[model samples]
Target: MADEITASDQIDEITDQQFLRAVTSFEAIIVSQIQVKNKLGDRLNNAIRAGIIILGIIAVSLLILLLTLSSQIGRISNVVGAMNQDFSTVSVQMSEIDTAMISMELRMKLLEGIAGQTQVMDQEVVAITADLETMRGTMAGIKSSVKGVRGNISNIAVSIDHMNVNVQQMGYDMQRMGRSARSLNKIFPFPLEY
Candidate 1:
């Protein structure tokens, strides 16, 4: 009976030891599984955070590009507007130049007409000068004729004075001859020598 009782006690002690070891192993497994799950969760969280940061950077870059493009578009619009204004100004200046050319052409035509009139006037003046020279020559000839007529009149007056003096002498001689003839006839009236 003592041997049997000793064998039972030893068996009971062995069983309790085995149960404790099993429980310890199960607890160790549960702890290891929990640690592995925590590690995996940490890695997943890091990857998700990295992906979000990359997406944010890309969005910021896109926003910056949009801003730069808008600025460039504004500068291009200003250049186009300036070009349009310059073209309008050039068109107006061209019209003014055209008007000035037209006015100059009109003035040239007027000058041409005046030049023609001046030519005709010059020819008329030349003709009048010739006519005046001819009149001067005619007047000179008339002056010479008048001088010759005055000389002839002076000679005629001198000849008429000489003729008047001869007439007076002839009248005196005729009276004396008549008186002598009468006296001779009376003195010789009684003496007739036969």
Candidate 2:
């Protein structure tokens, strides 16, 4: 009976030790898992921070590009305005030329009336007629030149309109880019807090 009791006690002590070892092993595994979780969290934080930095750089670059494009568009608009003013000045000059041509026509008619009144100046009359024909040819050439200038101005106006449309489209694209940047900012909040 005493031997049996000692053997049972020994077996009980061995089982107790085994249970304690299993508990210790489980604690070690839990600690290891906790360390792994911390490492993964740190890696995730670093990745998020890097992504935010990259997005910030992209946003800044887009802003700079938009500003540059806006400045260039302003310069182009100023140039177009100057061209319009120049066109107006040229139109005024063309009007003055037209008035001068009318005045010259009136003077020629007066000269013709005087030459017809004196039949003794037939040679002078022929010379005056030749001068009038030359003036007519010159006026025709001036008219053709004016027409060509008007056509060129029309083409320039069309081109300006096209440029304006392109600028408007670029502005819309810039707005969309701004919205996208804002959305990105919202998705990735700043990790640092005040």
Write the residue-wise lDDT of candidate 2 on 52-166 in tens digits: 8767866776676577667656766765676566567656656766665676676567677777566535655676566567566656765665675566567666656766776
Candidate 1 lDDT over 80-183, as tens digits, reads 56555545555554565555456556655666666868776566556555555654554454455445445544544554454455446445645654565455
Shift of residue 61 alpha carbon in model 1, Å:
1.1
Instruction: Candidate 2: give the clashing pairs.
Output: none
**Candidate 2 global TM-score:** 0.59
**Collision count for each candidate, in order:** 0, 0
- Residue 45 deviation, candidate 1, in Å? 1.0
CA lDDT, candidate 2, residue 42: 87
Error of 2 at 46 (Å): 1.4
Instruction: Judging by TM-score against the true structure, name the best candidate.
Output: 2
Measured by lDDT, the strongest candidate is 2
